[model samples]
Target chain A: MYCVHTTALSHRFSASQQVLKEIELAVPTGSIYGFLGPNGAGKTTTLRLLLGLIKKQQGEILLFDQPLHLHRLQLLRQTGSMIEVPSLYGHLTAKENLLIWQKLYQCPKPHIAEALQIVGLADTGNKRVRQFSLGMKQRLSIATAILHQPALLILDEPTNGLDPYGIIEMRDLLKTLNTQHGITIVISSHLLAEIEKLVTHTGIISAGRIVFQGTLNELVSRQQSESQMILQTANNTEAAQIVKTFVSDVVINAQHISMPLLSKEKIAALHRALVQHKIDVYEMNAIKKELETIFMELINQTKHD
Target chain B: MTNSFTNCLSAEWIKKRRSFSSWLVVVGACFIPLILTIMFLVYPKQILDLHHSGQFWRILQLRSWETMSIILLPMGIVLAVSLITQIEFKNNMWKQLHTAPVPFSSIYFSKLVLILLMLAQLFVLFNIATYVSVWIPALLNRDVPFPLYAINGTDVLKENGAYFIASLPLISLQFAISLQFKNFLVPIGAGLVLVVGGIIAHSWKYVYMLPPAYTALHFGEASGSTKHTDHNLTLWALGYFVVFVIIGYLLYVNRKEKG
Candidate 1:
C-alpha cells in the first residue's frame, strides 16, 4: 500500500501565478521516498499538502489508504513531519521542546530520552534550543517527529544546512528509522545527490509537476541507457566509421570516437569491427550518467517542453 | 480529545513559564499598582484627603481602577496577548503544531484560555497590591485612618470582577490580531492605535461598540450612582468576546504560513 498518494493536486497563489499544477505522488509503504526538485519547484508545497498543513485547492490525497482531508487528525496521528527549518521553541531546552510534542501525542516520558539518544543529542542536557547549533536543532526537530514512533515520517529538506558529518548522520538515522522501525519516510531535497544514497524510490518534480516517479533502480537503468562510451583509437576516423554501424550518434575527434553505450554486446561488436578494420584501439571507457545529471535532464526537458 | 486539551494546556504553561515575554506582561500588569503605591507613599496628604469626606477604600479603588482602565489594562492586554501568541509566531511553530495529531481548535483554545487566565491573575494581583499600598501607609502613619473594616470587601471584589469582565472583549480582539500578525510590533501598534482612537471616540454614542473603549465606559460607570454594576456592558463584552474568538479561530484555520 502507498503511504501517501496524491492525484490532480494543484495550488495557486494568485490568478496569474500557479505554485503547484496537477502534481501526483505515489510513496510506497516501508520505503524511503525522496521528493526531488529544484528550488521553488513546489517540493515543500507538495509536502505541506501531504501533511495537511495547507488546504488543498484541487486534489485527492490518500494517506495509509485513507483520504487525508476526511481523516486528517486520525491520519496525522500515525504520521510525523518536520517542514522547512526545524520549528522549535527557542526559550525552552531541547528536551522541553520534545516534551511539548510528547505530551501532545501522548507518548510516554521515556520516549523523549530515547528519541534524544537516537538523534545523538542525549548529551545535550539542560541546553536551551536557542543556544544549539543549526545541525543540533535539526536533529532535535527529527527527534520530536520520531518521538511518537509514527508509521510515516515526512521531512522536508531534513539535511538542509547540515555539515557533511551531520548529513551522514541524518542519512544513517533515516535509514535506521526506515529499516529497524518499519517507518515510511518521505524526504524532500533540492539536490538529487544529497538523498540519492538514502532513498529507495524517488519522485522528481519540475515546475510543480512530477516528471518522474519510480524505484531508484528504474531511474538508474534509465540513466544507464543514456550513458556514453568513449573509445580512444589510433585512427579515430576509421574507428568512428566502424562504430557508427553498431551505435547511433557516434562522434569522432582527433584520436577518439564517442557513442551512446547501447549495450555490452554492441560494444563487443564495435571492438571486433575496429580490430578487423585494423584500427588500433588504445582505450575504451563507459561513463554512466549520474542521478544528478538525469535529474537535471528531466527538469530541463520539462522547461523546454 | 480531552487528553489533548489537557496536554495543550500543559504545553502552553511550560512555554509561558520559560518565556521572557510572559514575565514582561506580568511586570506590565504591576506597573499601575506600583505607581499608585508610590503616589500614596510620597503624596499622602494630596492623595488621601479625609477632609473631603471621601471613603479611603473607595478613593483607592477608584484611583487604581481609573489608572488601569485608562491605559494600563488595555496596554497590558495588548502586550500580554502579543507575547503569548509570539511564542508560536517567533519560533515559526504554527506549521509544526498544526500538523501534529492534536486538533487545531485545542491549540487555539488552550492559548486563549491561558491568556484569559493570565489576565485574571493580573487583575487579582493588582487588587492585592493596591490594597497593600493603602494598608502599609496606614500602618506606618498612625494619623491616617485606615478604613480596613470600613471598606466593603464584596464591593471591591465585585468592582474588580466587573473590570475583568469588561476587559475580555479587548483581550479577545488583541489576541486575534496578535495571532494573525507574526511581527510583534504590528499587533502592538494596532492595539496602541485602537486604545488611543477608542479613548478619543468615547464621546460618540457608538463608541461603546469599540473594544478598547469598553474598559473606559465600564469604569466610567464606577464614578456615578451605578457603582460598577453595568450588566448591559458585561453582556455586550461577552458577546464581543465570543465573536472575536470565532473570528480568530476561523482566521487561524485558514491562514497559510509563508514558506
Candidate 2:
C-alpha cells in the first residue's frame, strides 16, 4: 500500500511565480522516501501541501489512500511531521514539551516516557528545551510527532543543520523508526549524499517538478546504463580503429578510448580483439561517480530546458 | 466536549504553565488589591466615613475597578490574550500543529477558549482579592467597624459580570489581531491605541459603538458618574464579540499559507 500518493499536484504563490508545476509523488508503505531538491526547489512546499499545512491551490493529495483535503484530519491523525525548525517551546522541558502534544493526540501517559526514551532524551527532566543542542531539539521533534505512533512521518530537511555526529544519529534513529516501528518516512533534503544512504526510495525534484523518482537501485541502474569506461592503450590510435567496429559511440582520446559501458563478456571480447591486433593494453578504468553526475545532469537539463 | 477538544484544552493548559502570561494574570489580578490592603492597613482612618456611611463595599468596587476598567482590564486582556495566542507563532509551532490529526477548528477554538478561561480566572481572582483586601483592613483596625453591612452579593456580581461582558469585545478583537500578526507588539500596540481612544471618548455620545469603550462606559454607569446612553451597550459588546470571533476563525482557517 502506498503511504502517500499525489496526482497532478500544482501550486503557485503569485500570478507571476508558480511554485510547483504538475507533480506526482508515490511514497510506498514502509519505505523511507527521500525528497531531494536544492534550496527553493519546492521541497518544503510540496511536503507542506502533503501535510495540509498549505492550502492546495491546484492538486490532489492522498495519504494512506485517503484524499488529503477531504480526509485531512483523519489522515493527519495517522501522520506525523516536522517542518523547518522543530518549533519547540524554549521555556518548557523536553518532557513538558511532549506533554503538550501528548494531550493533543490524547496518547497514554506512558507513551511520553516511551517517546522520550526513543529520542534518547529520557533523562532530560526539568531541563528546558532552550538549553538543548540543535540535534536534541530535532529528536524531540520526532518524538513529538511519533507520540501518537502515526503510520506516516513527513520531515522537511530533518538533517538540515546538524554536525557529522548528529547527522549519523538522526539517520540511525530514522532507520530504526522505519525498520523496527514499521513507519513510512518521507524525509526531504537538498543534498542527495545526506539522505541517499537512509532512503529506500528517492524522489529528485527540481524547478518544482519531479525530475527523478524511483528506488535507489533503479537510480543506480539508470546511472549504470548511462556510464562509460575508459581504456588506456600503448597505441590508442590503432586501438580506436579496431574498437570502432565493435563498440558503438566509441570516442578516441589522446591516449585512451572512451566507449559505452559494455557487459563483462563484451569487454573481455573487446580486450582479446585489442590484444590480437597487437595494441598493448596499458590500463582499463571504468568511470565511477556516475550517480552524482546523473543527478546534476537531470537538474541542469531542467534548468536549461 | 469531544475528546479532541478536551485534549486540545489540556494541551493548551500545559503549554500555558510557567509562561509569562500566567504570572501576568496572578499579578494583574492582585496588584491593586494588594496595594489597597496595604493602604487600609497603614491608614485605617482613610475609610472611616465610608464605613460609617455603609458605602464600604460600594466604594471598594468603585476603587477596585476605576483603574482596572479604564486601563488595566483592557490592556491586560490585550497583553494576556496576545501572549497566549502568540505561543504558536513565537515558538514556530503552527506548522507542526497544523499537521496534527486534530482539526484546525479545534486548535483555533482551543486557544480562544484558553484566552476566555484566563480572563474568567482573572475576574474571579480580582474579586476575591478585592474582598480579601477589605477584610484584612477591617481585621487589622478596630475602628473600621466591619462596615456594619453584609457584602452586597448582587451589586458585586453585577459589576463583575458587566466588566467581564464589556471585556469580551476587546478580548475577541485582540485575539483576531494576534492570530494574523506574528509580532507581539502589533496587537498590543493596536490594543493600546484603541483603549486610549476609548478612555478619551468615554463621555462621547456614540461610545456605545466602540467595543474598547465598553469597559469605561460600564464603569461610568456603575459608579453613577454618567448615565449609560444605551443600556444595550453590553449587548453591543456581545455582538462585536461574536462578529470578531467569526472573522478571526474564518481568517485563521481560510489562510492559503496556514503555518
Candidate 3:
C-alpha cells in the first residue's frame, strides 16, 4: 500500500523564490524512507507540505490514500510529526505535557506510560522539560510524537543535537518502531551515515528536485567503475607526460597520477613503463567508493549541472 | 455540536490552567478589587481622592459597580486584553491548539468566553467590595442607602436592564481589540488610550466612534428620551465588534501553522 504519496507537489515562497519545484515522491507502507539533502534544499518545507502543516501551492499530498489537508485531523490522528523543532512547552514536566496532549487527542490512556518507556523517558516524566538535556529533550519529543500510536511518523533531524550514545538510542528506537510496530518512518537528514543504517529506501534531493530516488542497492548498482590506473611516482609531472602518450583524460594530483588505461594489457604495459622510468611506487591501489563519498560525488555532479 | 464545543473549551481550559500566564491573570484579576477595597477601608479620607477634593466617605460610598465601571473598569479591560493577546505573543501553545482537530470557532470562542469570564470575576469582586462598604457604614449607624447600592441590582437593573445589556457591546469592543493584537501591551495600551479618547470625544458630539468608556456612561443622564435611539453609539460598538471578530477569525484561520 502507498502510505505516503505526493503528485507534482510544487510550493513556491513567491514568484521569485521557488522553494519546492514540481516533484513526485512515494514511500511505500512499512518502509523506512530516508530523505537526504543539504541545508536550505527544501527538505523541511517538503515535510511541512506532506504533513499539511502548510498549504500546498499546487498538486496533492496523500496519506493512506486520503488528501492530507482536507482530512488533516483524520490524517493527523494516524500520523505524527516533529516538523523543525520539538515545541513542547518548556515549563511543563514531561508527564504534564503528555497528560495535556493526551487529553487533547484523547488517545488511549494506558499507552502513555508505555510510550515513555519506548523512548527511555519514563524515569524523567515528572521533571520539567526545560531542565532536560538536549538529548533528553529530543527523546521526549519522539515520545510525544508516537504517544498516540501513529502509523506514520515524520521526523525532521530527530537525531540533531544528540550525543553519540543518544544518537544510537534514537536509531534503535526508529528501527524498533519500523520493524516491530510496523510504523512507517520518513526521516530527513544530511548525514549519509545516519540514514545509511536504517533507511530501506532513499530519496536524494537537490535544488528542490529529487536527483535520485530508489533503493540503496539500485543506487549502488548504477555506479560504473572508471577504467583508470592510479600511479604513485616520485615525479607525477614526468609520469603524467608518459601516461598521456598512451592514455587520455589524464588526471594529476599532488602524489598520484591517474589516466584511463585502454585495456587490461595496457595496464601491464603502463606498469612496465612506470618501472622503466625509474619512478618509485609507494602505493597503486584501485579506489572503492563508499556511500558518503559517493553521495558527495553525486551531489557535486548535480551542482555542476 | 454543544458537546464538541464544550469539549474543546474544556481542553483549552485545561491546557491554559496549567500555564503560568493564566495564573498571572487570575491573581491580577482578583488583586485589583482587593487593593481598591483595602485602600478605601484603611487610607485617610484625602488619599482616596487623588485627582479631586471629594470627601473620603463619599469616595468610599461610591465604590460600587458604578464607580468601578468608571474608574476601575480599565483594570478589567487590561486584564481581558492581556489574557487574549498574550496567548499568541508568549508561546507556541497557540500553534499546538491551532493544529488540533478542533474547530477554529471553538478555539476562538473559548478564548473569548474565558476573557469574558475573567471580566465577570472582576465585576463580582467589585460587587463584594460595594456590599462591604455599605454594610460597614450601616453598622456604624451612619447615613447610607439600605441594601447596598449595587449598580446592576439597583437603578440599572430596574431601568429595562439597559446598563448590563449596554455593557455587552462594551465587553465585545475590548474583546475585538484584544484579538487584533499579538503584543500583550498593544491592547492594554490601546484600550487605555480609547478610554481617555472617549472622554474627550464626549464633548465633540461625534463620540460614537469611542465605546469602551462612553458605552456605559448613559447612566449619568436621565433615560427620559422616549425613543432611546443611541444608534450611533450602538452602531459604533457593534460595528467594531463585528469587523474585529471577522478580521481576527480570518487572520487566525489563514495563518500558517509555522507562524
Candidate 4:
C-alpha cells in the first residue's frame, strides 16, 4: 500500500504566485522516499499538504487510503511529521517535552524512553532545549515525532544545518527506523547526494513540478542514457569514422574520441570492430557526473520544457 | 473526545510553566494588597479610621480596586493572555501544534479554558490576599484592630463575582487579538493604549459602548446616576464576552495557515 498518495495536488500562496502545480506523488509503504528539490521547489508545501498543516486548495490527498480532509486526525495519529525546522520549546527539558507529547499522543510512558534512545537522547537529562546544540535539538525533534511509534514518518529537510557527523547520524537513524523498525519515511532535501544513499525511491521536483519519480536505479538509468563515454586509442582519426558507424553523436578530439554512452554489449561490439580494423584500443572510461549535476540537469530540463 | 481535550489542556498547562503569565497572575493579585499592608503599617490612621467608621469592607473595596478595576487588572489580562497565546508563535510551536492529532476547536478552547482558569485563580488568590493584607497589619500592630465586622460572605461573593464577570469582556477581547497577531507588542500595546483610553473615558455618558469600560463601570465606586447603570454592565460584559469569543473562534478556525 502507498503510505501517501496525492492526485493533481496544487497550491498557490496568492493569485500571482502558484507555488505548487498539479502534482501527483505516490510513496510506497516501508520505503524511504527522498523528495529531492532545490530551495523554493515546493517540497515543503507538498509535505505540509500531506500532513494537513495547510488547508488544501485543490486536488485530493490520501494518506493510507483515507482522504485527508475526512480522516485528518486519524491519519495524523498514524503519521508523524517534522516540517522544516522542527518547532521545539526551548524552555522545557527533553523529558518534560516528551511527557507533554506523550500526554497528547496518549501513548504509554515507556515509548518515551524508546523514542529518546532511538534518537540518541536517552542520557540528555534535564538540560533545557535552549541549552542543546543544533544536532541535539534536531534529534530531540525526531524523538518527538517518533514517540508514538508512528507507522509513517515525514520529515522536511531533516538534515539541514547539520555537521557531517550529525548528517550521518540522522541518515543512520532514519535507516534504522525504516529497516529495523519497519516504518515508512518520506524525507525532503535540497541536495540529491544528501539523501541519495538512504533513499530507495526519489522524486525530483523542479519549479513546483515533479520532473522525475522512480527508484534510484531508474534515476541512474536515466542519467546513463544521457551519459558520455571517452575513448583513447592509437589512431583517433580512424576510430572516429568507425565510432560514427556505431553511435551518431561522435566527437573526435585531440588523441581521443567521444560519443554517447552505449550498452555494455554495444561497447564490446565496438571494441571488436575497432580491434579487427587494427585500431588498438588503449582505454575506455565513462565520464562521471556528480549527482548535483544530474539534479541541475533535471531542473534545467524542466525549465526547457 | 474528552480525553483529547484534557490532553490538549494538559499540554497547554505544561507550556505555561515557562511563560511569564504564570507569575503575572500571582504578582498582579498581590500587588495592591501588598501596598495596602504597607500603607496600613506606615500610616495606621487609615485602618483606625475604618474601624471607627464601621464599614471596613467598603473602604477596602474602594482602595483595593481604585486602580485595579480600570488599569492593572485589564492590562494584566491583556499581557497574560498575550503571553499565553504568543508562546506558540515565539517558539515556532504553532506549526507543530496544528499538526497534532486534534481538531482546531480543541486547541482553541483548551487555551481559552486555561486563560479563564488562570484569571479565576488570580481572583481567588487576590481575594485571599485581600483578607491577609488586613491580617498582616493586625499581626504587626497591636493598636490596629483586626476587622471585627461580620464578614458578609454573600456580599464579598457578589462583589468578586461582579468584578470577575466584568473582566470577561476584556479577557475575550485580548484573547481574540492575541490569537490574530503574531507580534507580542501588538496585543499588549493595543491593550495598554485601550486601558488608558478606558480609564479616561470610564465616566463618559455612553461608557457601555466600550468593552474595556465594563470593569470600571461595574465598580461604581463613585455614587452617581451611573450606579443604576452598573447593575446592567456585568450583563452587557457577558454579552460582549460571548460575542468576542465567537468572533475569535471564527477568526482562529478559519485562518488559512494557522502556524
Highest TM-score model number: 2
lDDT by residue for model 1 over A79-169, one digit each (tens)?
9999999999999898889888888888889999999999999998888899999999999999999999999999999999999999998
lDDT of 3 by residue, A1-305 (tens): 77999988888887888878777788889999999888887898899788666777898899999988788878877877776666677767788677756765667777779888898888884577779888887777788788888899989988888888888888998999999999999999988898788899888887787788888776665542433467888888988887887877889998788765356677678778889989776766555456777777767776788
Enumerate the candidates' DockQ scores in order. 0.59, 0.82, 0.28, 0.74
Q: Each candidate: how many clashes?
A: 0, 0, 0, 0
Pairs in steric clash, model 2: none
User: Over the stretch B92-158, how does candidate 1's per-residue lDDT look in tens digits?
Assistant: 8988988888888899899988987887788777777777777766777766667544769899889
Model 2 over residues A1-305: C-alpha lDDT tens digits? 88999999999989999989989999999999999988898999999999887888887898989898898778887988899888899889999998888887777889999999998999988999989999999999999989999999999998878999999999999999999999999999988888888999999999999999999999998988888889999998888887787776989878678987888888898899988988889888788656778888888888888
Order of quality (lDDT): 2, 4, 1, 3
Candidate 3 CAPRI-style tier:
acceptable
Worst 10 residues of 3 chain B by lDDT: B219-228
Poorly placed runs, candidate 4 (over 4 Å): A241-249, A262-277, A280-283, B148-150, B221-231
Cα error, residue B12 of model 3, in Å, equals 1.4
Model 3 misplaced stretches (Cα beyond 4 Å): A220-284, B1-4, B18-21, B43-62, B75-80, B83-85, B125-196, B199-202, B214-240, B256-258
Candidate 4's TM-score: 0.95
Error of 1 at A105 (Å): 1.5
Query: In model 3, which residue pairs have backbone atoms overlapping below 3 Å?
Result: none
Between candidates 3 and 4, the one scoring higher on DockQ is 4
| lDDT-superior candidate, 1 or 3 | 1
The best-first sequence of candidates by DockQ reads 2, 4, 1, 3
Between 2 and 3, whose DockQ is larger? Answer: 2
Q: Which stretches of model 1 miss by more than 4 angstroms?
A: A235-255, A262-278, B43-56, B135-151, B225-231, B256-259
Could you give candidate 2's per-residue lDDT for residues B1-259 as a string of tens digits?
Answer: 3778878988899899889899899999999999888988888876675676567788878998998988898889889988987888889988887777787788888898988899889989999998888788788787776655688888788878888899999988989999999888898899899888988887787889889988888888888898869568878989999999999999988888878
